[model samples]
Target: MSEKQQRLVLSIIEFLNQSIADGTVKQDDREGLEVAVQCIGEAFGVDPNDESQVGRLSIKPASLSSLFDLFMKTRERMSGSTPSTSTPSPAASSSKVDKEAAEKEKEKGNKFVSAKKYNEAIEAYGRAIALNPSNAVYYSNRAAAHSFNNDHPSAIIDAQKALEVDSKFVKAYNRLGCVFDRIQVESLSNLSWRI
Candidate 1:
């Protein structure tokens, strides 16, 4: 991993560690936070299991600021605070039409889906949505990816958003149905096992 990327990972880990130490994070949530840190470490080619190595990792000031922003956003999300979307970001507010760029991202997402990289596909579809939020296809594509990732809630949200954007979006309905069906099957299986 590049130095900057390494720094970013470390900074996120540090934030999580601080949250836990300060009792801001509940005991039940600590495991998930630890797993998230491990995933970040793995993504950046670091072994989070090695406490010595994790301690040696250095974080730059710029990376710290970015990490702080990310932490704040995450805190807000955890608190169920809705982000203001009345004003779009600079990239989204630009006058230039980037339909081609959005299409390119969609294609990239498709390629990732074909490769069975659902997480990467979700990211690509997110970029497509950012570039062109009006496209219902992007949301539907992301919904499919989220389903593949076993993130049923996110899949449902994306599918619903797609339908809101275009009520006639057949794929969104299909994906939403599939996700609900899977959840039902899983629930039934669990109940049967308990019985």
Candidate 2:
């Protein structure tokens, strides 16, 4: 949380803290998000008790996402030939995507998953990823759909992609576990047959 890292990291901390406090985060994910927010809060200089200040920093979660969107576009502009290591691939960078639209596609994917339409869920998640290649959640959710469809290889790939985009994402790890669990079961069944 150095001032040098203030603008971007601070926005992330604010969004994550709000996501946890509002109870909008999934139950399984709350603990991890809380730990991250707590760690960042410790390094943050803002005093929760200070009331003398006439104003305080506040950023909407959507705004935080938009900040990333803006940065990606700016980075694309500054380096026209090749994307930096932190930037998305050239194919993904060429398109201007709306963050909120990507979120909507994710929601649609979730609905499709809940309905047991794994194919539809995968498609929706694919659209989300195409719109926002930087979002780990989209890849993680697509991994879920792929696993549900019994496409273990695709699930593994998507889960790995999710981790690549956001290393701290717990859901991507869970998605990988889902794929591995199936593989383990198959291996054990084969062993039993040989015995």
Candidate 3:
């Protein structure tokens, strides 16, 4: 990692440590924190569990202070505690892409779908949605997986959610129409059987 990148990872670790010490992070938040730590570890090419690697980062105190300041400012902006007047930095733009860890979960869902493991695919897609609710593709993929599982209601809901996220998501509309048609056919079949 470059010096700046190293400092950013270190700053995140420091923030985690401080939050833990202050008991600001609840037990429910631990899983999210763990994911953040794992991402940081991956970015820095270091094992978060290994204290020795942290020492090896050779982060100076001055750098840590500056990083912490930036971290706090970013946090405030994210929390809407401060208005974001300035344009985002390049690092910030890259970080936004990095935050889409949901992409990994979505890929897993796709693998499950390809294997015809509809239930597993739904579960993986659900996790992906939980991680990034605004991702229209995740919802659209999940909707298809739900249809494969013979879960028309869930498929409809997911497709609708995808449309809600991105109105121009044509695939979601197509999926939704398919699910509705299936439901209609099932209803007609049931009516004939009742006759």
Candidate 4:
């Protein structure tokens, strides 16, 4: 690994240590270190051009243990399998292609959001939502972009829609709470200053 890659790994390791200190990572997980590593690989976006940084962007375990267990088990299962080893049928190939295209559209949306191009981001996310309507993340992401543009009403509507689709989405809940908090604080300040 390059020096940059080494530094990234060290930074993530430090984060892991802090999480452990804060009781984010349980002691039992230490026994399944390999599974954890694989889980990291499955979640992280490995660069196509730089496979060495496969687990560069590490994610943490959610509050739910069962879901984390499931993710780790799935990653373990996939670790033994090679991408080129599978002989996917024609229907499977077509389905995979469709999924990839949808993911590509989502990437474009994310790029626009990162660029602070809120309106264009919303449009890109809209296209992604059309391609994968069932995905709650698409709606939630667009809602965030809408919020960034100061379209709080539209953001609230989209966030509500996302929550309707996936009630378990904590991100949607957090965003909604933040929006409500902003409104509440503004109204409270106005009322207090009016007197």
Candidate 5:
């Protein structure tokens, strides 16, 4: 990594360390944050404990929070200077294309479901969901694929994600209910077998 990037990583490590010490991070997550600091330090080939590494950022941004705030302000300034236009910005155009692509991927997933290829269906729906995470139907479709694959845990998670995306989506609620029913039935079946 470049020195600039390393400096930034060092600043992030410093921030994480400070959070751990200041009790901003939960006690349970402190160890994981420490591990993350170690990994970031190793990845950047910089030692967080070494004062010099942490001091480099002091020239401009004393900490990661300040650096981020500076970045956001700069972004706001840049955005304000852009002229209003009828044509869409590149990012907005890209989002439109992504929505179309997500729909296509969802169609592919539906075809896979009809063919009883649960894994392929799951992968297709995953791509769709990744592209357009706001779409509850993609998540619900993935949940169905997971259910067909007998992956109850994944089905439950996807259903929950679907609900998160659109709370009023009845399909997600049904999918969640169905997964719970299936789990109950499986538990009963296993108990009966044991008996």
Candidate 6:
């Protein structure tokens, strides 16, 4: 592609990244994002159908999801309402305040996790859970800490609690599946040794 065309494609990619970061588009709108990228590629005389080029055009998952995504996803996991990609609700200001506090605690917990302070991370997550008992993420995060500490039974318990609060929570399902698999593997290993 010519220099001008390359610049245009880059510009379009940047715009899309910004939209994704701002949570203006839903995480599930990957197809629409791909179409938009394809259109931009075509406008710049590039082969939009090229798989490598398409892959390069796509947003990074970590970059695509912002803190807002976490908040919305956690809320969705608990409540059945689909969070609109718009301004915060005035009617739920008080609840939002509570959520914000919980999120702050979660951030601290995340930091502790990154530092490998498993026990402290668990405590922070516990605080978040206490503040926002309805948030599935709080339970899920605490379960992760438990798993890291090799406490599979506690992890399973917390994962179950998370799913109990939010049956549609995908992360909880994945965690539960992982814990179950681990338990099965342990049981089989013990049986083989015994035999």
Judging by lDDT against the true structure, name the best candidate: 5
- Looking at model 1, the pairs that clash are none
lDDT by residue for model 1 over 1-195, one digit each (tens)?
675576457767777777888899999999998888778777788764565554445432223554354445434544555445312223334234677888999999999999999999999999989888878899999999998887887887787677556656678778877886666566445445444
lDDT of 6 by residue, 1-195 (tens): 665455346546656756777888898996689678778767776553454543443322212233234445556646766445433322323377788998999999989989999899999999888777888898899888877776776786687667656667789867756764665455445446444
Give a tens-digit lDDT track for model 4, residues 5-104: 5434434544554566677777887546535544553454333234233233222111124234334533443364323422221222235556667678
When summed lDDT is taken over every stretch of 10 residues in candidate 6, the lowest stretch is 58-67
| Error in Å for residue 150 of model 1 | 0.6
Model 6 clash pairs are none
Please identify model 1 stretches exceeding 4 Å from their true place.
Answer: 1-97, 191-195
TM-score of each: 0.50, 0.49, 0.46, 0.46, 0.51, 0.46
| Per-residue C-alpha lDDT of model 5 across residues 120-169, encoded as one tens digit per residue | 99999999877888888998999999988888778866876675555567
For all candidates in order, the CA lDDT equals 0.72, 0.68, 0.69, 0.59, 0.73, 0.67
- Candidate ranking (lDDT, best to worst): 5, 1, 3, 2, 6, 4
Which candidate leads the pack in TM-score?
5
At residue 170, what lDDT does model 3 achieve?
80
* Candidate number with the higher lDDT (4 or 5): 5
Cα lDDT over the full model 3: 0.69
Off by over 4 Å in 3: 1-100, 188-195
Error of 3 at 194 (Å): 6.8
Q: What C-alpha lDDT, on a 0 to 100 scale, does residue 60 get in candidate 5?
A: 29
* lDDT tens digits by residue: candidate 3, 1-195: 675576467667776766766788998887788778778778787664665555444343324554344445445544556435433221223235544677888999999999999999999988877767777888899999988887876786687667556656789878866775665455445446445
- In model 4, what is the error at residue 121, expressed in angstroms? 0.6
After superposition, the stretches of candidate 4 with alpha carbons farther than 4 Å from their true spots are 1-95, 185-195
